[model samples]
Target: MKNNDMLKNILVWVVVATILMTVFNHFSTQGQSATSRLDYSDFIDQVHQGQVSQVIIEGQTIRGVYGSGQSFTTYNPGDPGLMGDLLDNRVKITAKPPEQQSVLMQIFISWFPMLLLIGVWIFFMRSMGGGVGGKGGPMSFGKSKARMMTEDQNKVTLDDVAGADEAKQEVGEIVDFLKDPTKYQNLGGSIPRGVLMVGPPGTGKTLLAKAIAGEAKVPFFTISGSDFVEMFVGVGASRVRDMFEQAKAHAPCIIFIDEIDAVGRSRGSGMGGGNDEREQTLNQMLVEMDGFEGNEGIIVIAATNRADVLDPALLRPGRFDRQVTVGLPDIRGREQILKVHMRKVPLAEDVRPSYIARGTPGFSGADLANLVNEAALFAARENDKLVTQKHFEKAKDKILMGVERKSMVMKESERRMTAYHEAGHAIVGYLVPEHDPVYKVSIMPRGRALGVTMYLPEEDSYSYSKRKLESQLSSLYGGRLAEEIIYGEDAVTTGASNDIERATAIARNMVTKWGLSDNLGPLLYEEEDRGGFMGSSRNANVSGEVSKKIDEEIRNLIDRNYERARQILVDNHDKLEIMTECLMKYETIDKYQVDRIMAGEEPGAPKDWIEPDDSIPPAPEVKSSLEEASEKPKEDLIEKDMSNDEVKEPGEPKLH
Candidate 1:
């Protein structure tokens, strides 16, 4: 490297010197030509006329100053009378021999520029041909772009990762194989040549791969799938070969490829047959992974969110033998991830990881890390010494619902309408059987909405039952229904546009996808998939009459839910009004206040509300309603076990 840099420097200096010499030669030639040229006859005529003042004679050249003091030059014709003529004319005469340049020096001067240009061209060509270092040049295009980190460089062990315990355990055997390959070999067991980590983005797939490398104490080679491909044909294949060769050179090393879907998409499924470069790259990778020529000690780990798009051949037993799912963390996993990120922040005594985790269901590892960082920033903005629970609450709310649009001014009438709309959603969700609890409701503008009502599930739910989905559909219609009841149907605003769309989609899916409608039977009536490289295929073919019936079923489902929501709101109209009034006063209200309003009582002040300190003025607070109501007593609230029949009557509020 040092030699190459020194050579480059020397070349630069040589070019600079050549340019300077060329400029100097040009100026010197210009100075020599300052005297105008004169014909020999003209000079002789001038001397005879006594117009020449002085002359300097060389072997065949004469330079002289005319009577007017202008300098001129002429060539001599070897006339013997020239000297006598000059003497007779009384012109000042001096004679000397002509100066001669060596043949070699003249040739060197004449051809220097061409030689310099050729030398520069050759230097650039050599540089492009990877003459300096075997990286980044066109000649090195076939070389792998994978970055290698020695065992000592990677310090991310499994302990550093908190949410992806299952992924770690899945790859643990690979680490063992790297540590003691003989143990597996003795039992006629070969380690998996490739492991594919499948997950959504930011779920710690890359982190898990690094942890595996750390655990094995082996070299880690990392690259993106897109890096192998190029505009040129066959380059991707070459890169794949080169990458595998490098991994083989560093035996027992782990190679991690992120976003493999970029190059691993199913072949022959694209519009114009397929991408040749990408397909070739995927083919080479498949061969290198588990080919006839065994790569015994190399382990290839790849991560992708779109596993469905990958070539099926790549997922076969010999290639990627195992697939580890790095899914979003559950509640417990989220709590652990929160704790991991919380370690870097100065926390107040009120900062509880478990509580934050519960509020942030379905959060990935990266999301939790960001949450912790956001909380820290919130604390820093307030000039607080420690991150408090309120900070985390603000961060979570911002992430979930988007930043508050506090500066947005709404008319009092609109604000009142928003309050009623949100209150309707909260009340319907609270009363509906099999529905998640109404976590909070607010009339304050947030993101694109003038009001928001949030729901929180007590536990992580992987699937929804028919009852739960029906309840969700009903709750979705509650807002528009509330508007219709408060103001006549024609007075309803477009604020419930999103709610109508969601509710319609749910009802349609219930009929078409979920087969929840009795008329649809236990069959799917969904439209054909319009995504993916290959052409779409309809899941089920229905006659035109059946399609009409399907639409009818969807409409019936929506109507039923809409009426259910309307009836629920009408039955609790007084409670709804009370909740809306509370929302208008507070701008936001939590589940505790919601429960009090539903029970036909005033919400009053929050139990956890504290008097502001007189000595130190309070900074602006951005606490979420959930966090504000967390301290409220919950012993008397309605229990989850309450049956739907218990509150079927109008004006009867269900109590625990």
Candidate 2:
């Protein structure tokens, strides 16, 4: 921040210095160019009267030296008679050949210092990260904000990126085409004009694009879709033209636009009325990509998480010729990503990349990178030389659930209630068939929840059966049932609100979208349009009668599952009490401990947990406002939504 302020001050000084110098130069050159200025009539009179010794001609301006050692300057009257009068007066005429000064050159010379000052200011502003956008004032509105890089100049290579090898290979072909276009052109094949990378956020789409640029050995241009649009009319189109012209000047180059959906969203569908400025920009971009003039030797690469929202014109074959799916990294890909990130960290002997990979099933490359960074942070906080598996585990939990709220004060009564609430979830999950095994349960707060009960799947499941869905619903309701059983209906707290919300959403989806209910049959009851990609709903298509039935069906699914949860708790009422007591004692416990207590065995030491070093002070825990509740814990709504393949409820697994 200090450096930025210093640079800003320096830039201000530079601009002021340049302006003063320009003014000083303008005034300083006046006495040297000509001593005095005379009207055109006075200069002609001097020339005709023979008072002028000789004339110096430069374009329309005239400078003359008199016999009195005085010099005068004026504009030519454009009269041929004046030259004849000068000749008749025996005046010496030293007419130099017209200086072939280009108008552009003259203009450049006049404004060169100002332009240089502005350029320097822009350079400093960009360095300070403000950028030369509207923030630079109105004159900079039309400028292209694209960042350019040369293959040899950029440090990011294909090797720097991991977990998306197939995406790398797909984009690598563009590099090959740029390196040797004739290899495929000779075989009557034309290179694709554009490639669109479609993926979820943090899936390394932009990283892959950068790697492609590094490997291509050609000029690369990168800009976000939002950079193209401006409040000024025609600015976006002007920038698009400028960008394409620059790409053409450096042929066989790549132009990458990240988050193209920002500008490339379906035209005329914007909230405002149609014929907006953004629509105009998109139209111009379409024209430039594959218009009447082909964008030959220029490959346009675009990336967007919401490709479903982009204009069809932008996605059509001739423009974005290929669509590459850069999905979340699988186990092997995640392991590779972890290894790549692990290179930067000092890992202990116990730190296993494969084990971490297995634990992080749906992590993207960015997530894995963050995981490695967090683990390193944890190690540093412990004052340890190397990041251990225990640090990695804590990092994963922090990333998933949130950092533990160690400083949060909990009363004895509230803590007990939290214990029973979490124990209910674990007991039902452990007893339910087809449900994922209970991984951990904790009454001590983490994130927004007062307590958490996590489930870890033994293996990744692509498809969920009806039985598994039922079991999930049953497990979701167990916390609420236990609260009612222990505290009675009047005393149940709002802590179960989020869990119920998630469970209800799942049940609703099953009836309205999934057609899981026998009454709904195999037909989707909700409004579904193939046009709305990403499975987004535009509106409900059902009538009042159908909507009523859908509501009833959802309610029935929830009620049945709620009853099943109640019965499971009722059958193991004594075990539930024991688990709650164990939770109150431990504050935090794992699935192994829960199982042991349920099996009537003494709870053992936490499974595979590394004891914290008491000599070293732990890192200060940072709280997330997203999960900090007014009374109870708030949920990480984003993580809950992202982890929809498993339980959607915010609980212990969310912290995993």
TM-score for all models, in order of appearance = 0.76, 0.74
Compared with the true structure, what per-residue lDDT tens digits does model 2 show for residues 1-656?
Answer: 99997987798778778777976785585547577889988877777767888777776777888989788888886878877877887777777776586899789778877887887777667756567565344456666778789777877888988888788888877889888999999999988888999999999988888887787778889999999988877889888998898899988888999989889988877655556779888999999998899988999999998777888888888899799999988888988899988998888899899888888877888889999999999899889999999999889888876779999987667787788799899988888889988877888788888888878777667888888988899999899888777655645789989888899888887887777899977677766564678666644666888888888988999999899999999889888878888777667787678878889888866755456668987566554422232124212221233223444566565544
Tens digits of per-residue lDDT for model 1 on 1-656? 99997898798878778787876886485328446888898888889999999998887878899889988888888888988999999999898887787999788778877877886776776656655446666568788999999999999888888877778888889999999999999999998888999998899999999989998899999999999989887899999998889998999899999999998888987654554788878888888887789998999999998888888999999888799999999999999888888888899998888888888877888898999999999999999999999999889888887789989977667787798789889989999999998777878788988889999888999999989998998998899888777665645789888988888888877887877888778787876574734645354677998989988988888888889999998898888878888887778788788878778777985554554468976566565432233223323221212234243448777798
What is the alpha-carbon lDDT of model 2 when measured against the actual structure?
A: 0.82
**Which candidate leads in lDDT?**
1
How does each model score on lDDT?
0.84, 0.82
lDDT for residue 546 in candidate 2, whole number 0-100: 81
TM accuracy, model 2: 0.74
Q: Considering summed lDDT, which 10 consecutive residues are worst modelled in model 1?
A: 634-643
Q: Could you say which candidate leads in TM-score?
A: 1
TM-score of 1: 0.76
